[model samples]
Structures are given as C-alpha cells and as structure tokens.
Target: MFYHLLFPLSEHYALFNVFKYITFRSAYATVTALLISFIFGGWVIRKLEQMQIGETIDTDGPQHHQKKSGTPTMGGVLVLTAIVIPTLLWADLSNRMVLLALLGTVWMGVIGFIDDYLKVVKKRPKGMIGRFKLVGQVSYGLILGSILYFGGNGDFVAHTSVPFLKDVFINWGWFYIPLVILVVTGTSNAVNLADGLDGLAIGLSSLAFAGYAVIAYLTGHAVFADYLNLLNLPEAGELTVYCAAVVGAGIGFLWFNAHPARIFMGDTGSLALGGALGTVAILVKKEFLLVVIGGMFVAEALSVMAQVTWFKRTGGKRLFRMAPLHHHFELTGWSETQVVVRFWIIGVLLLLLGMSSIKLQ
Candidate 1:
C-alpha cells in the first residue's frame, strides 16, 4: 500500500524513491514487524493468560519441563500477525506468489490455532491427535500441489533447482505432486519438532527467513540469477518483503519467547512457520536447499522418528535420552538454554552454508 502511494512520487521527492527499492522496503517491513511484536507482545500474552492456555508437556519428557506447565502458548499467532500486517502494508499485493504465501500462512495458522485451542481450552491430554495434524498437513500439501499444478498464473514446473550444479534443473512432471506433499509434510513436522525450547525454533526460523530474503532477491534479479546459475523467477522479488517481515516478527517474539519464556509457539507457530518456509522455497525454486538451510529442523525431527522407530524395533530400547534432539541434551544435563543457543548457532552456520551453495558453483 505504501509502496504504491510513495513509489510513484519518487520522481518528485527523492525520499519517496526508497519505497521503490526492494531492499529498502524489506528493511522497513522488518522494522515494522519488530515494532508490532514489541508493542503487542504484552496484549497477546495477557490474552493467553486470561484464557488459561498452557502447554501440556508429556510425562515421558524432561523433568524440568514440567515446571513450564502453566506458561502461555500459541504465541506463534502473534508472530504471524506481526509479519502479515507489515507485509500487507508494504508488499505489492498483486504478486501471485506473495498472495499464495500469505494464504499458506493463514491456513496453517488456523489449523494450528484449533489444535492449540483443543489442548489449552478443552484440555485434551495430547492436543489434537496426530492423525488430525497429519491430515491438516497433507491437506495443506494438496492445496499447494494444486496451486503449482493448475494455477496457470504460477504454471512453471520447469524443474527443481539444485544449488551448485551446472544444467541441474530436476524436473518431476507428475512426480512433482508427491514431492510437493513430501515437502509440505516434512517441513511442517520438522519445525514442529524443533519448537521444543522457548526460542529455538523461532530463532532458527528468523535466520532462515533472512537467508531466503537474499535468495528471493537474487532469483528475482536476472543478472544475479544468471551469474549464480540459479533459477530465474520473475516476480519473486516481492517475497523479500514478507521474509523481512518474518525476520522482524521472530525477533519481536523472541523478546517474550526467550529463555524462561512467557509463552510458547506450540503447534500454532511451528506448523505455520514450517509451511511458510516450504512455500517460499518452492516459489524460489530452492526446495531442495531447504534440507541444508533448515538442517536444525531436520535433525530435531529425525531424532524423534529414529528414537521411536528404534524403540519399537528393539525390546524397550531407545535412540536418544529423549527425542527432538534438544530434549536429549536436557536429559543429559545440558540446560534448556544451552541446547537452544547451541542449536541456534548451528542454524546460523547452516544458513551461511546454504547461502554459499549459490556461489560455491
């Protein structure tokens, strides 16, 4: 909105031209989201408190987590709100990819909100069952698959881009549908698993968004995309505004979500963020690189699956002291803060490595 109003007058006022630049607008979006998060953090937390919404830590997990029993949850809603509001205010709404990403954000957030509500308000022991969450995720995947398949506006499945290879666009044709499902489902759950600690998941998500902002900008630029041998996505530059919004929102949420967090993201934040992450990657044709950039999420999710699968395969045996990787550290005497920070460091490193792939070729 501001872009439309201000950028046109760029010729008349030198200051107005800043709105025409993706970089400048992205920075503005980031700052706007950060301010929204800080200003409204208390209100959101207060509402959660009034509603008595709290996380129900499983009895099988770390003993220390029990102390966090009554903390507010579903804080991801605030983060999403901050991001969406800023993006809408600063982004070019006519961009189809941006619209789709916004839709993905709201859709996943609604599903997650319902799950959190069931757990927090209705007091279900496990929150919405695993089957329900899986169904929601699969449904989201199908929605995206259809959009990529039949949404003529975005009708270009030329091939998936590989980061550091020459002539390496991997086309999937009909197989792309299954790949879409896998990407959506895998990313949603991976981030979900990584949300074990207060600020871990959101922090990593912030870093990933920062990297993706640059990727989107580069892919949308013909010269840069050509130089890096990346997929040239024409309308992708606007996505940087949304990515910056997320980066800002994450930082804002971290103000309250950090160690001894006042609230948790719960499924509301994690699932939605994961979906948003995957959707952006798909738009940028960087779906394959997600595994590298979001390595923390993958490691966390894998730890849980491996632990459960190995336990069932053997008699009363397990893989880690706990699952989700971070819990295992907690069980091994590392403080929750330590695990979160160390994982954050890993997230930052992975993001750099992922970024390097574009130039590594």
Candidate 2:
C-alpha cells in the first residue's frame, strides 16, 4: 500500500524516490513488522487466554515440558499478521511472486490454525489427523507446482538451479510437479517437527529468511545475477520485502517465544513459516539451497524418521533416547537452553555456508 501510494510521487518529490528501492522498502517493512509484533503481542496473548486456547503437552515427552501444558498457544496469528501487514504495505502488490508467497503463507496458516483449534478447543489430542494434514499439504503443493510449471511462461520455471555448480540447471520435465509437492510437504513437516523447543524453530527460520533475502535481492538484479552466474529472476526481487517481513516477525515472536516461553506458536506458525520458505526457494530457483539454509529443520526431521524406522525395523530396540534431535540431546543431560543455543549456532553456520555457495558458484 505504501509502495503504490507513495512511489508515484517520486516525480514531484526527491525523497519519495527512495520508495523505489527494494532495500529501502524492505528495511521499513522489517521495522514495521517488528513494531507490530511487539505492540500487539500481549493483546493477542490475552485474547487467546480469554478464549482458553492453551498448549497440550505430551505426557511421554521430557519431564520439564509438562509444566508448560497451559501456556496460551496459537500465537502464530500474531506472526502471520505482522508479516502480511508489512508485506502488503511495503511490497509491490502487482508482482506475481509476492502474491504467490502471500497465498502460500495464508493457505498453510489456515491449515495449521484448524489443527491447533482441534487440539486446543475440541480437545483432540492428535489434532487434525495425519492423513488430513498431508492431504492439505499435497493439495497446496500440486496447485503451486502447476502454476509454476504451466503459468510461469518462462524457461526456468520447470528447472531448478544446482548449488556449487555455475550455470547448471536441472530440468525435471514432467516430474517437477511431484518434486514440488514433496519439497513443500517435506519442508512444512520438518519445521513442525523442530518446534519442540522454545525459539529454536523460529530463530533458525529467521536466519534462513535473512540469507534468502540477500539471495532474492541478488537474483532480481540482472547485473548481480549475471556476475554470480545465478538464475536471474526479475519478479523474485520483490520477495526481499516478504523475506524481511518474515525475519522481523520471527524476531518479534521470539521476544515471547524464547526460553520459558510466555506463549507457543503451535503448528500454526511452524507450518506457515515452512511453507513460505519453501515457496520462496522455488520462486528463486534455489530449492536445493534450502536443504543447507534450513539444515537444522532437516536434521530434526531426519532424526524423527530415523528413530521411527529403526524402531520398526528392530521390533523393540530404540534408536535415540527420543525422536527429534533436540529431545535426544535433552535426554542425554543437556539443558534445554543448551540444546536450543547449540542448535542455533549450528543453524547459523549452515546459513553462512549456504550463503557462500551463492558466490562460490
């Protein structure tokens, strides 16, 4: 809104010309989202409390988590609000990439909201059934993939850029749709699985978005993209504003989501954030880069899968003390804060490594 309303006045005023820069708009978007989150966070928490929406702890989990059973949850509403408002105000609404990113965020957010509602309000311990959740994810993936493949009207739409290899692209041909479906669904679940610890998932997510914000900016600039030998995606530059919003919203939510959290994001925030990241990666032709940028999420998801597979294969033997690498560390005597901080350190390192690939290629 601000972009459309104020940018046109650049012809009459020199200062308004600043609005034409993605960097300028992105910076303001970040600050706007941060302020929104800080200002409205308490009010939203109070509303959730008034509605009796609270967290449901698993009895089989770590002993310390039982105390957090009643903390107000579904705080993702605040996050989504902060992100969407800033993006709408600062981003170019006419950009197709921006519209798709917003759609992915909102669509995944609704799915997560419904699941949280079932768990907290309807008292369904399992929340939405696994199959139903998978269906929702798959459906979104199919729609997104179809749009990118058939509606993109570009040569790179059906191809993905490979990391560490300059000028290399892989054409998935007809398999692109299923690949997208897998990436979207897999990423959404990975973030969900990593949400066991306070601030862990969101903190890492913020870093990932920060890195991608740079990538988006570079990919959108023809000169930079050519110099870096990256896939030039003109429309993707607008995603920098969206990514900035995510970073700010994540940090704002972290204010209350940290250790001894005042509120939980539940599945609502996790799934939406994951979906948003995945969609952005696809838009920028950096799908493989996500594996490195979001390494912690992938590790957490892999741990759960490995644990389950081993348990089933061994017919009784356990793999880790628990599933999700964080819990395993907790069971091994690491304090909760230690696990979260160490994981954050790892996430940061991975983000740097991922960023370096952009130049290395």
Candidate 3:
C-alpha cells in the first residue's frame, strides 16, 4: 500500500527517507496502533456490552471471577484492527512474510470469531469443542507446513540460523514436516492457554516480537549476518517490519486489556497472535528458538495439562489450587491485579533470558 507507493519516491524526497528505516516506520506503526486501540477500544467495548457479548466465567473454576461476567468479549478485534491498518500503511506489501502474516491474522481471527460467536451469540456453554479447535489449529499447521516444504521457498538449508552458534547451522530432516506441524499447532495452543489473564499473554508475546525482529534484521543484512557468523537470508529482512507491527499491536491491545480490563481478547486474539508468532518464526528461519523465547507460554499451558492429568489420575484430586499458575495465586489470596502484574514481571524476566540467548549462544 503506502509503503510501496511512497518508498520509491523516498529517494527523490528527503523527508521520505524516514520510510527507508524499519525502526522509524516501526515507531510510527507502534504509535498508530496504540492510538487506534486507545481511541476505538472504548467504543468497541461499549458496543459489545450493548450487544450483551460478555464473558462467561467458569463458575466451578474460580469464585472471584464471577464478577467479570458482564465484561465485554471479543476484544481481540481491537488488536487485529490496530495491527492490520498500520501494517498496511507502513509495511512493504510485496513481502511474502507480510502477506502470510496478514493472511494468518485474518484466518485465525475468523476461527476465533466463530468460537466467540458460538459462545456469545448462540449461548453455547462450550462455545467450540476442544476437538474442533484442535482441528482448526492442526489444519492451519498443515497448510503452513506444506507451504514451507513444497513451495520451493524453504529449500534453502541456510534457513536454520541460530544466533551465536559459531558456524553451526542445523537443518530439518525429512521428518521436519510433522515437526513443523507440531511446532505451529503447539505454539498456538500454548499462547491460547496463556491468554487466560489480562495483559499477561500480550505482554509476553511482545517480547518474542522484539527478539525475532532483531533476528530478522540480522539475517537480512549480509554484513551483520556475516560479521556475526549467522545465516544471511536475503528476503527475510522484511520480517523486521512484520515484527515491528506485531510489537506495536501488542502494546496497543494492552492499553485497554490491562488489569481492570475494558475487554477480553478471548480465543480470537490468542490464536491469531500465536499463529502470527509461528509464521514469523518460520519465515525468519528461527522456528526452533521460539521454544526458548516463548517458554513462559509453554510453562503456563503445561501447568494446566499437568494439573488436569494429576487430578484425573488420582482420586485425591490434588494439584495446584488452580491451573495456569496465575489462578493458583488468586486462590491463595492474591488480587486479580496482583496476579496479572506479577505474571507480567515474570514475563519480563523470561524475556531477558530469551534475549540473552542471542548473545550467550
């Protein structure tokens, strides 16, 4: 869109030179998304409230959450809206990664929207069944994985670029297809589970964008890549712009999604964000490192599964007071805000650790 039409003219117009810098455009993108979310978030929340699209707290799960029953649902729309607009205006529309990212935003968004609609409109207690959601995620993984494998685009073994590896490049074997499917699907579900708290998921997800964006930039710049002994991916640099858009969008979404949440992102945001992260990782050729960068999400998701499995296996029904770890603190007398903020702090720490991997490796 504006990126292409205005970029060529950048050479002729001195002011347009700002468009050449991903950092500059990223700043604008971040501000644009933040403004959009801050301005429109209230209206969207009001509309949802009027429509009676509210949260349905699991009564058996947590007692205090019942008060959140009337909170507006489907807040993920705000994030998607803010992200798409600025990305279109500021990002290179010709980039394959950007196009795939846009497609991922729309595709997973619709899937989430359908689930939210079923719960909010149709009044289905279960909304979408677990199996159906899994199917959707798996289907997405299949599409993305196959595209990466057969599109002839991913044939470049130079794809696996781990920072500080000192010339050690790892390529995926033939089993990489199933491995990729597992990566994308698992990653999406991991983020989906982490989205249970206000600002928690989005905040942690932002850290990933920060890490991957730098990786994208390094990979794209031959000088940087060679100097650092990392893989030099020619077209992958555009991922920096995509990563910037994601960071901007997350901050914007967090504006209204803070503790006393004006709106809840629901599955719509979690799935879409997760899918977006996975797509960027694949494109940037750092699919494996995502495990370390997004470790918090994995830990949160695993907590739930571990608790459930333990409870079912033992008639004693023993586990954390609640799953997701955050709720466990809630049951232990921490306020919602307390749990949310502490989780955010933990996320910040983990983010630093993940970032350290770049230099430590």
Candidate 4:
C-alpha cells in the first residue's frame, strides 16, 4: 500500500524514492510486524482466554508440560495478522508471487484455525479428521502448482536447481505438481509436529525464513542471480518483505511464547508458517534447499515416522524414549530449555550450511 501510494510521488519528492528499495521496505516490514505482535499480543491472549480456548495436554507426555494445559492457544492469529498486514503495506501488491504466497499462508492458516477451534473449543481430541486436513493441504498444493505452472506466461519453469552443483537443474515436468503437493503438505505437518515445545517451532521457523529472505533477495536481483548461477526470479525480491515479516512475527511471538509461555500458537501458527515457507521456496526455485533450511522440522517429523514404523514392525517395541527427538532428549534428563536451545543451535548451523550452498556452486 505504501509502495503503490507513496513511491509514485518519488518523481516529486526525493525521500519517497526510498520506498522503491526492497531492502528499505523489508526493514520497515520487519519492524512493523514486530510492533504489531507486541502491541496486540496481550489483547489477543485475553480474547482467547475470554473465549475459553485453551490447550489440551496429553497425559503420556512430559509431566512438566501438564501445567500448561490451559494456556490460551490460537496465538497464530497474532502471527498471521502481523505478517499479512506488514506484507500488504510494504510489498508490491500487484506482484503475483506475493499474492500467491499470501494465499498459501492464509489458506493453511484457515485449516489450522479450524483444527484449533475443534480441539480447543469443541473439545475434539483429534480435531478435523486426518483425511480432511490432508485434503486441505493437497488442495492448496494443487492451486499453487497450477498457478505457478500456468500463470507466468513462460516465465516460470518446472526446473529446480541442485545445491552445491553448478549448472545442474532437474526438470520435473508434469510431476512437479505432485512434488509441490508433497513439499507443501510435508512442511506444514513437519512444523506442526515440532510445535510440541514452547518457542521451539517458531524459533527454528524464523531462522528458516531468515535464510530464505536472503535467498529471495538474491534470486530477484539479476546481477546476483547471474553471478551465483541461481534462478533469476524477477518478482521474488518482494517476497523478502514477506520473509522479514515472518521473522519479526516469530520473534515477537517468542517474547510471549518462551518457556513458561503465556500462550501457544497451536496449529494456526505452525501450519501457516510452514506453508508460507514452502511457498516461498517454490517461488524462488529453491525447493530442495528447504531440506537444509528446515532441517530441524524434517528431523522432528522423521523421528515420529521412524518411531511409528519401528513400533509397528517390532510388535510394539519402541525406538526412542519418545518420538519427535526433543522428547527423547527430555526423557534423557535434558531440561526443556536445553532441548529447545540446542535444537535452535542445530537449526542455525543447518541454516548456515544451506546458505553456504548458495555460493559453493
């Protein structure tokens, strides 16, 4: 909004020209989102409290977490508000990539909101049948893939770059649609699985977005893209503002969501944030890079899968002390904070490794 209204006046006023810079707009977007989260954090928590929307803790989980059973959930509303408002205000509204990314975020957010509403308000333990949730994710992937395949007028390609290999690209052709479905659904569920600990999922997600923010900026810059042998995505630079907003929103939410949390983000935040990140990676043609950027989420999700597979194959024999990796650490005498901070450290290391791949080629 500011770009559309104020940037035009750069012709008459020199200061207005600053709005044309993605870096400047992205900086403001980050600050704006952080402010929005801080200002509205308490109010949103109060509303959730008033509505009696609280979390339900499982008896089998860590005993220390039982105390958080009633903390207000659905804090993702605050995160989405912070991210969307800033993106709309700071990004180029006409940009198709921005619009698609916003659509993915909001769509997954709505799915998560419904799940949270069912679990918290309606008292449904399972919350929005598993099939329905999968359907929603797959449906979103179909829409996004269709748009990317058909909307760009030959600008968009089904070829994705391979990290650490110069001039190496894989063309998925028509199979890219299924790949998109898998990426979107897998990432959304991965983050949801990792949200068991306070400040864990959001913290790692923020770092992932920070990495993508740099990738988006570089991909959109023709000189940098060419120099690095990356895909030159003309509209991707605007997504830097979106990524910054995600980072800012995550940090602001972490202020209240840290251990001894005042509120929980529930599925709303996890799904929306994960979907947004996946969409951004697809738009920037760095889909495979998400494995490295979101390494924690992938590990968490894989732990669950491994545990389940092992349990079934071995006639109920357990793999880890618990699934999701963090709980295993917790059961092994690591404090909750220890697990979270250590996971965050690993996430940062993976982020740096992923970024290095951008240049290693």
Task: Report lDDT (CA) for all predictions.
Answer: 0.87, 0.93, 0.79, 0.93
Tens digits of per-residue lDDT for model 4 on 1-361? 9999999999999999999999999999999999999999999999999988889998889898899999999999999999999999999999999999999999999999999999988899989999999999999999998888777643346888888888888888888888889999999999999999989999999999999999999999999999988878889999999999999999999999999899999999999999998999999999999999899999999999999999999999999999888999999999999999999999999999999999987
TM-score of each: 0.96, 0.99, 0.93, 0.98
lDDT of 3 by residue, 1-361 (tens): 6677877797789777777777777777777877888789889988998999998988777876788787898988888888889889888887766787787777787788889889888999788988988788778777777776777645563246564465556666555576666777777778887877778889888888888888888878899877766567777787777777778888877888887777899878888888888878877777767877887887887888899899989975968998887778888998877877777777777667766666555
Query: What is candidate 3's CA lDDT for residue 292?
Result: 75
CA displacement after TM-score superposition, residue 360 of candidate 3 (Å): 2.9
Per-residue lDDT of candidate 2, residues 1-361 (tens digit): 9889999999999899999999999999999999999999999989988998999999999988999989999999999999999999999999999999999999999999999999999999999999999999999999999998899664558888888887788988888999889888999899999999999989999999999999999999999999998878899899999999999999999999999998999999999999999999888989999999999999999999999999999997889999899999999999999999999999999999999999989
RMSD, each candidate, Å? 1.6, 0.9, 2.0, 1.0
User: Candidate 3 at residue 122, lDDT?
Assistant: 97
lDDT for position 128 in model 3: 92
- Give lDDT for model 4: 0.93
